[model samples]
Target: MCNAEIDPKTVPHMRELMAGLPTNWGKWGPDDEIGCLNYLTQAEVLRGVASIRSGKTFTLQVQMGNPKGDPVWPGRRGAQRINLMDKGDFICGNGPQTPGCHEFADDLMIMYLQGSTQYDALGHVWYDDHIYNGFDAKSTAGGMQKASVLPIAERGVVGRGILIDMARHRGKDVLDRGETFNHHDLIDAAKAQGIEIEKRDILLVRTGWIGSFYRRDPAEFYTDFVEPGLTFSRELVDWFKEMEIPNLVTDTIANEVTLEPETGVMIPLHCALMRNLGVAFTEIAALDALAADCAQDAQWSFLYTAAPLKVVNGSGAPVNPLVIK
Candidate 1:
């Protein structure tokens, strides 16, 4: 549906962009309103086809934090928090004294996205007055549902994947926090890795920042100037927008720029990626092992699966994402 009050010239390529999205089984009305058909007869057929394809799937887990360990943070104290606790307790009982089983239990704080490796939907963030899928930021404060909200459940992300080792590109075993990664650096890494990004692909970035924080002092890791993160640049945003990628995952604290000195702001990439383009993001993914495996096999795509907790209007969820190659 087109907005009559809004100037069509404002978004000269709006039609082209809309064409790129999947088919809409709904109707458009005046005032830019959309109404969906209650139940489509063809929906079941399409779902059956999808289920058939999903039967032969592979998966890999990309979580890093141990349940018995402390949570992973950026600062020195934060670093120590990871795996600080020991294996705690177990509840064992017998079923009518016939058999006994023990369930090991511990207070767990996981740092990875979606309980493990995961993706952040475009509805996760907003900028100015715009959100993912071109939703109005004002109307979203109350928490929009489905398309307006981050549809982590609806959009099953199964596609090609690419990993760019930014740390290796910079000739460092690991990167510290506050380390800036520019758009050019990303481009160079892609070139060096000999990977060509394709539309609807999942892009994975390995900054090595996770490794540094995992091994270094929390204070130093958080305050250090060598931690790798995606730097905010118009060019980078433009690149992703032009590429029309679907999802992005990274082995960093956040998927985008953090703590800009000049602007004193964090999450510049958040606004660009989540707000402008409807691209999903995931952070703190355990990618080192996966990256190593990929490097050996020269393969990137895998059966990637992540399911978030069903929390109402939650800003984020702890996920345990696994990739099966």
Candidate 2:
């Protein structure tokens, strides 16, 4: 990990930094919203089903309201659940009356769509006044009018997922703060696990970062606040394009190193891969148990399916991805 302090002036603009990368703008169609998700064809669905050796399943979403506080990006509060109706309310004579004497408990949650394990809309981040499929940045005013998560939620994501455990490959419980890895490192880690990342596979990389968040102090966790994840590079972007990787999932707040060490750019991949190339990002997933099981059984591939809450014109949506191995 590079420890150099970042200077805002030295960082290049996103447009200048991502000058020559190829985009997926007209590949699908003029009205395409969900991007590389088109790669999950019927055959790809069958391929995922074939990888299901056992009946065991894992849910990749973290608990929404942890007593110790849920893990979230700085400045965004975690999900807050407040009871609207409960036995206590009935006891206090404040509950709604029912003709048949039926009572129920109800609660409401307030949170950022990206607050938990989530699927980011293709328009979630952009520069140069453009989003995925060249949608105007103005469509995001008030709410997303193009490339919103609703399309993704309606379509759903299902495919063969390959887990690349970076921490285990590097012999660490968790990668250090701001630790970075690229496509080459990903390939090496996949090789070490005796797995091949097939084209169009849902790429799930585990850095053990989220696992450590539970054990460490919240203040310390946010102190230098740098997530260990894939760093932006031209070759890495090319690899993703060539491989047709649909989704990139990780156990980090942001799916890439917070700041590019060399260019001092914040989440360049969000602009390069997501905005330009149209790759879906699933972040802050719970991959500890799944990684451990894969390590034990030596089965790194499985069927991955996720349907984020359908939110109209939303920038992102919460999701609880299901993994069957």
For 139-194, candidate 1 gives per-residue lDDT tens digits of 55665443332345443445445677887777877765567776577678877777
Candidate 2 wrong stretches, greater than 4 Å: 1-9
Candidate 2: Cα lDDT at 55: 72
Task: List model 2 lDDT by residue over 1-325, tens digit each.
Answer: 2233555478777888899998999999999999999999999999999999987899999889887778898899999999888999889988889999888999999998999999999999998789999999999999999999999999999999999999999999999999999999999999999999999999999999988989999999999798999998899999999999999999998999998988878899999989998999999999999999999999999999999999999999999999999
| TM, every model | 0.64, 0.96
Give, for candidate 2, the lowest lDDT window spanning 10 residues.
1-10
Global CA lDDT computed for model 1: 0.52
Residue pairs in collision within model 2: none
**Residue-pair clashes per candidate:** 30, 0
| C-alpha positional error of residue 14 in candidate 2 after TM-score superposition, expressed in Å | 0.4
